[model samples]
Target chain A: MKVTAATFTNLSPEWILLGVVTLLMLIVAFSKDKKQYLAVTVAAIALGFSAMCAFYHMNETNQVMFMGQYLITPLTSFLKFLTCLLMLAGLLYGRDFITSRNMQPGEYAILILFSTLGMLALISSNSLIVFYVALELLSLPLYAMVAMERNSGRASEAAMKYFVMGALASGFILYGISMLYGATGSLNLNEIAQQLQTTAVSHRVIFIFGAVFVVAGLAFKLGVAPFHMWAPDVYHGAPNPVAAIIASGPKVAAFAFFLRFLLDGHNGLVHQWHDLLIVMSVLSIVLGNVIAVVQTNVKRMLAYSSIAHMGFVFLALLADNPIGYRAAMFYVVTYVVMSMGAFALLTLVSKAGAEAETLNDLKGLNERNPWLALMMLLLMFSMAGVPPTVGFFAKLGVLNALVHANMTTLAVVAVLFAVVGAYYYLRVIRTMYFESASNHKPICLNWDERALISINGLMVLYLGIFPAGLMSLCQQFVG
Target chain B: MIQQVIFYLFAALLIFSGVRVVASRNPVHSALFLVLAFVAAAPLWIMAGAEFLGLVLVFVYVGAVMTLFLFVVMMLNLDEVPRSKGFVRYLPFGLIIVGLIVTLMLNVIDPSHFSLHVNAGMIVPQHHSNTKELGLMLFTQYLLPFELAGALLIVAIISAIGLAFRGPRARKVQDPSAQIAVKRNERVRLVNMEAEKKS
Candidate 1:
């Protein structure tokens, strides 16, 4: 029961992140100076290094660290690696964006690092208490980042809504944990699963009560239907890079969160939760797509599309197999890449004064900047699941998983929603390519920014054509 | 019999204050009533032999969290928050939810679940201090999660600072880094006029 040095080694990734954030915080605090460049460089280098080190730790599997509350397995390592990768990309895109907006890059980078750390812990957590704490650590930064633009009234409003709703979700999760503890006398996920199997039939109802609350709390985090009221507003009101983080990295982490708590803990209660997920998935897909088609704001539209995307990912959960989980992992990784590119482009194109909030902003994009236009076209095409792009394969992979699980009707409905979802993405492309410019000024980006965006965009196409590398990588660890 | 009397005493007041937390018209009153409910409920836990939980609940919830609730409630624009326009309309749904929860609890929770027939868990002597035992387990067995919870607080601090911090504006400011990075030749004259001032 003694804490040992090996415990630190097993938790190397988390320790490195902690060290980086603390160093950044101290440097920022001591100097009455804003060294935006130093902070960003330090964060980028540290995250990049930590992400590379994550591969070494992957060799250790099923080993518990810190009294069985933290586990090191291939799945945890892989998810952590992907999360770190997405976060590094986000920070790279955010650096110039944060500095240009007159926000302190040090605080911004610190919050992002802390949030990533939260997600890392969340994915590897083995206890309900650890999971809740990690979930908060993951979320607290987001609330602040959403309203990081303090001078903006709309940002403040969105921050309030997000905080209140997020706090409520946390409360629900806490209540569920307490209820489960009351029923099973255990907080460890594996122990809870074991205890549930032997629990009397009468007590299973109490377990179900807790299960429902936990599901609702998690659903709120995922921003799926009936619990998605906060997503679009937060996305639209937040700074573009912050919204990009919200939209991409935490989502995959949320899936890992779901998988751990459900499959690892409450697999005994499948009959209790299966139907609830089905309803949530269907509503999310239908409503997310339908609402998106009407949104004129590019960010809001993408927010809705992200919800629908989650609905598809939820289908993988319903499939309840290793292949399905791998498919989900692949789908999520691709979606994250494509979404990050789209939002980073949004960040780049928005002039310091006005935001790219509406469809009209894309008008004459081709005439103004052809390369930017091409990037948007490919990113949008990937989002729409067009062939030769990874989005199609991602969608196809998930659909095949569904069919293999004998979910024909759900698969058919999902395809219908996908078609509906495509309309808005294509609308964005049409505005960019077909329309003429109202104001004749080029969308300007620096060489580095331009290069960064180009690489991200090209990767979408490259990965789509050569999906096996990522797919096999996902399969090696998942399930 | 003494335990029964104490249980009933706390339980009655707890329910009454709990009802007032929702029914009170003023938000401030509701928050205060919530504190009252917490204070009343702690004794019930103590009566049930959960001495550690009782004291901690009082110390943490009533002492810390409710005080915060009062501070925030009093700072708010109470007039802006409508008191009862939608109350009547929402009451039915709220009541139905309460009804369902009570019904479920009644149907599923057996009396035996609350009785003292359950065996003592793990290891604790007849006079074991619950707080000490908890500390031992938490610091040793659950150290990682315990540390994670600490990290969560650090995040909370940063988040509060990020969201709420606005630099003091319209005032002259100095950067220490800029000052420290300055060379002697930059601001100080080569003639060394500063040394001449002593004369």
Candidate 2:
């Protein structure tokens, strides 16, 4: 509980990350205006150094520090490490996009790093206060980044819309937290859980209402159906590189928050929340997929697809077992990789002034650049949960967990929705292969962007074909 | 007692000002009414012995935030926004929603229907002052959160700068720094010229 040397050692990842943030600012301040290339180098090393620190601490056993403010375990450490890798991939894919748009590279890289730090803090937080602040830390920079393309009216509109809705959601969460505090008189999750055990039935109802508010707020952040109204607009409006980070980075962190809050804090009332999650899960999958089928804008379609994908992740949590947790972890990790791959290709194909986003943009892509088209096909296949891809294994893992928990009917319903979802992903593939572009010019991609996409695609296939090792590894953490 | 009467006065005025805040046609009036509502609510907090919170509500929110609200409201072209219409037509639906919410609030708050006994009346603790106790706890156990709040402020400032402040765009005057880039060979050319005749 004291501020000892062990506390410093245990939180070295965060400390190193903080140092990198300061170092980044100094580098930006000292550098010339034309030396924007250094931003990528600084960011890469910052992410690498922090990831190394996290990886170094990966084998550590669970330890509660800062008087239970942060609870670092092997799982949180491992997820932080993976998130750093994902951000690194995002940066690589986005490097050319940033260069073309003349985005302030220092600003872009630092926001990404700060958001990553927020996620790491969120992952390790054991108290609601810590989690909430970390959530704000993650979102504040993102709002600004979403509006970074200054010339576009749509970008500013998206930013304003996101900021307002996000504030409302945070209000809901704070109200819920206040109500929960009134009921239990504790902000610490463990203490709340303990107090909840002896609470009367009437107080339990109050707690349930509080928990509902909390879930609704979180559902907004995760971009589930009904609360997912902002996602399509934001994704379609923001610059491609920023949109990629929005889709990948925050999603993984949101899933981490879900695990921590539901499993750790509200696990005592799992029965109450299980039905709530099911309703949201079913609604998200059904609505997200059904609406996605009609979308012509590629980015908007992917946004809806993300909603459905989130629904599947929620299904794993529906069972609330160790196996279910592992399955959810695997699903989220793979989904991030697959989405990153698709968006990277989208970024690569676009020029600065003309963003390539519509279905027409992909027409005859196969003829223009066969390799790029193939990668897009693979990414689409993975998203559609087709065979020999990570997406298939991810869905299969969650469904298997559902079946194990005796939810066959839910599993069947999910599979039906997955079939519906496949239609949209296949629509993308069909556009790429079956049609020819009216205004055709081949995409010129830098080697870095191309190599990043290739590695991302290969990762998806490799994880799909040999998923057992990672699956069991996830199981080892949650089990 | 006089305390009960005063409490009722604050509550009644708060409700009145709160309604006017939403119903006022002029945004400037609405902002003023909002400040009034906040002022009314603060007295109730003071009556509960939370003097620090009550005073903070007045100073931080009513004094500063409401003034900012007025400035923002006035910054917009007020002539562009037409006065709202259809108040009577929408009244029935609004009433229904209000009725539903009142019922829901009553359902949860009715302690007599359940054994749950929330404090319906104010009680002042005798051992310590309100602000003193809060300061003690905030400085000790909640120190990290207090620091994190400062961090949130920093984020807000940075975001505001990033999103809103693009420095000095669309200069009507020629930039001297840009003019400095002109070279003699680029800006001027020397040529053999024919002498003009007097015409």
Candidate 3:
């Protein structure tokens, strides 16, 4: 809370995003409906600068700011940088989709910017209150973004479902936080950890009770099974671009939130929360993979796949070592990249005449737009964890962490479920390549978008081959 | 002893009104019971030395928010709607869950488990002000969350407008600019005297 020079300097990225949000608001106010498209480019540039600012301040790590309410660490800076970049990519992928659908691109961009600001704050949050506020700031925009398609009754219903579930999750977290505060008389994560280390056995029971609720709430936000009821419905019902945004940066931010809550705040009680995570992870892998195979809608399929992927992240987290955390970080980063690329391709295929939602919409995509189909093939292959893609390495890293922790049984079960998960992703590829084209029109994209998709697709391959650099960086930061 | 008696009286009243707020069949009655519950609870805070919180809760929540709730409930005419019939079917499960939760809470909050760090009989000094202490903490140590909550409100406003706002309506709206641009002569015309013969 002190008005120090370091505080402003450290928080430059958030200030930049907040400034961009205000600027977008003014632009939306002044400009006519059609002219508000300019806000997208403005927001993209602001996000680029924000990411650059985060990278520039990467070395100023481990500095607890605002009376230990906020943190600036190398890991947080890296996650923030990734979140901004992913949001920028998501915005680009969504640009044509929003404008074509007559959804206000200006408002869409503003909400994305606000959500990104919230993610940045969530990544840096060091205390329970900041975490809760940042989480709400992150979620409120998403609910509106999902409901932005005002003409669609389905989207409205999806928004309602998301709002109710999100409210319940927030309530759980709040109630747990209140209990934790009562038990420890502190809000700062490190202070809570310190208190827990010395607290009596009787106090530990209340702390564990609070931690159970908190873990359940975090699992809900992460969309792991048993708490993942809203993901598929929201994904299928929301507009494509909003789904893309939901699938990307927010996952990374949610991982950071998990780390702050469990690793930072309640590390002393790992043996207790560890059991809860095990049940959630096993259920997520089992249910997400099993149910995803039957999905006809591509969005719902991706939603289920995301649940399975988060299960792998939780597996890495279960190892409870630096290597395990690094693997979890790597897995989340890889998942975000693949999910963003896949959804962006979905946005591209969806034309004006018909919303390309079902698997049949993607039938024989190879014949109509081979390049776009190739990009999608790469993304799907990556998602399925084929040998040449980053997804394989990400899964491998998680398994490695699990084996290192001597949880070979869980590792084997994960591998089994992953094999089941691969069937659906390959089914997407099979529909694109093996099936006959029904919608004969070719999907035309601007050169820049095509190139962006190309880079997104190739990054999966390139990172798979050269993951040593990012892997080492993850290791270094987690250390 | 008098303070103890007052505490138990209002505490009982608070719990009773709280239950009635949920159990009342009439929505207006429920809202009124809620207001009473808020009123009953404010005294507890004041008695606990949080005078500012107690007064503000009464003023802001009871006076403004509960009154607004009452107006909305009355306007909605919810009493005309029939209640759901499945409550009896669900009551057993609900009671079981509630019982379990109460037991767990009682176990965790058992007074014997806690070694009190603060002396229970400590008295407040003359002219002590918890309001000032609360303000100082809010503006100093807790400022990050305070400001973040402000930002959250902005997001709430944006989402509210984004979801609810439609474009300009075709219905007639006031033209404030045109209203202000009217000249004196335009608004009121001077005319020559034209007296009618009917007078």
Candidate 4:
């Protein structure tokens, strides 16, 4: 408990992230020049440093930092690495859009770094209090980010809706945690589980209610049906890069936390929660895919698509097996790649005057830019679960895990909904290739944008074809 | 005895201010009353043995956020609170919900089922400090959830930024065609005038 330089050294990664974020904030505050690239450079360097720290910590076995609230475990390290990479990509995509719109890049970068730090903390949190604090920390900044486009009414509406729903979800989660604490006289997940195991099932109704409420709150975060009302509006209203981060980073972290809390801590209650999850999974798959088919706005379509993907991931969770956990992780990774790629392509295709939100904007995209069109094709195909793309394998992994767990009916429903999802994804492809180019000139792509697009597109193919190693790693983690 | 006195005092203040917050006619006054409620609630949190939460509530809600709320309310000029017919219709439902909650609490805390004793096992000793024990338990046992909270905070931050930076479509005044078509000559015109001698 003694404060010393050595103790600080033990928390060097966290310090490093905080320090960089602080630096970015200062730069944003002091620098009058809007064209300053220092913030971007600092953000990139910080991301790289975090990645390195994560890599270093990956092999470290169960080292608790920050007086036990934070941990440096392989799971935390892996998630931190993935989140940092996604943040970096998001930052790159954000740069041109932010700058073009006269936004303060320094503040934007700093907030992103701080948010990323919060996410890392959340992923490594050891207590309910720490978890809630981190959740709030991550959430408060996103409310601001969603409202960052200060003048847009839609943006304001999106921010308002997101805030209200998020607050309600937080309330639900807090109430659940409090009820759990009241029931078990403890907030620790391990202790709660132990207590539940010992206590008579009839006496644990409060705990069960708490667990249900907590899952309901998490479902809101996951954009599962009955609580997914805000996803489409928020996703469509926010900037594309922001939408991409919303779709991937938070969803992945939420799933990670869900697995940690539910699968690891409450595995005994699998029978209790499994049916509920199965129901949610089925509803999410059906509703998300069905609604997405009719969306004219590209962002809204992807938002629904993301919801469907969450359903797929939920299907994996329903399996309640190691195979299921690994499949879920794989699905998240693949989904992130495809979602980022698709959004990145949208950013590239959008001209300065026009926002690439509608499907009509993609008309004749292939005629203007073959490379982008091809990239879009790959992403759409991947999303549609076509072969030779990562999405195909991602879905296959989830289905296989579900089948292994004797959830064949859920797997069938998933595949059926996936077919429904394919229609919308392919609609974009058709627009990109089959239609004639509009009279307007195609948007020019910057080098960073092109690089991201290509890498994201290629990753889908690479993972689909050579997924053995990654699958094994996931399996190891799932174990 | 002192702890009980402080708890009751803060609890009373919290309830009074919370009522005022909802019932105040002016939005600004309502926001101010909410701040008072939050401040009072912070002490109640401390009484509940959550020191961190108490401090956080004071710092975040009472100090910073409520100030922002006050500012926003002050800036927006509203003549009066909008009276809605829906409020009257929902009043019975609200009261019913409140009644149900009270009944539930009463059942849970029935004196016949459980008695409060000074030396009961459930009560902590006067000298016992919860913070240290809480810290230990949180770190040693509830580690993953603590980290997951951190990730949730990050997501919150991202969502906030997204909300703030949402583009203003209706108010935006950019015509790309006009901007792209403006020639250099049009932007930089050289006008020459002949000067005549005036007597």
Better of 3 and 4 by DockQ: 3
lDDT of 1 by residue, A360-435 (tens): 9888889988998899899999999999889998889888888988999999999999999999999999998889
User: Which order, best to worst by DockQ?
Assistant: 3, 1, 2, 4
Query: Could you say which candidate leads in lDDT?
Result: 3
Q: Sorted by lDDT, highest first, which candidate order results?
A: 3, 1, 2, 4
Relative to the real complex, the DockQ score for model 2 comes to 0.43
Candidate 3: where is the Cα deviation over 4 Å? B20-27, B73-79, B85-100, B113-124, B173-199
Model 4 Cα shift for residue A40 (angstroms): 0.7
> Where in model 2 is the C-alpha error above 4 Å?
A26-30, B75-77, B83-104, B112-132, B168-195
Per-model lDDT: 0.84, 0.83, 0.88, 0.79
Record all residue pairs in model 2 with backbone atoms less than 3 Å apart, i.e. clashing: none
DockQ of each: 0.51, 0.43, 0.52, 0.23
- What are the interface RMSDs of all the models? 1.7, 2.4, 1.5, 6.4
Query: Docking quality tier of candidate 3?
Result: medium
Cα lDDT of model 1 by residue, B71-176, tens digit: 9988884743357588789999999999997897777666656445653444547887878878988888877778778877988888788666776578778889
Q: Native contacts recovered by candidate 1, as a share? A: 0.78
The DockQ value obtained for model 4 is 0.23
Comparison by DockQ, 2 against 4, better one: 2
- Residue B86, candidate 3: alpha-carbon lDDT: 96
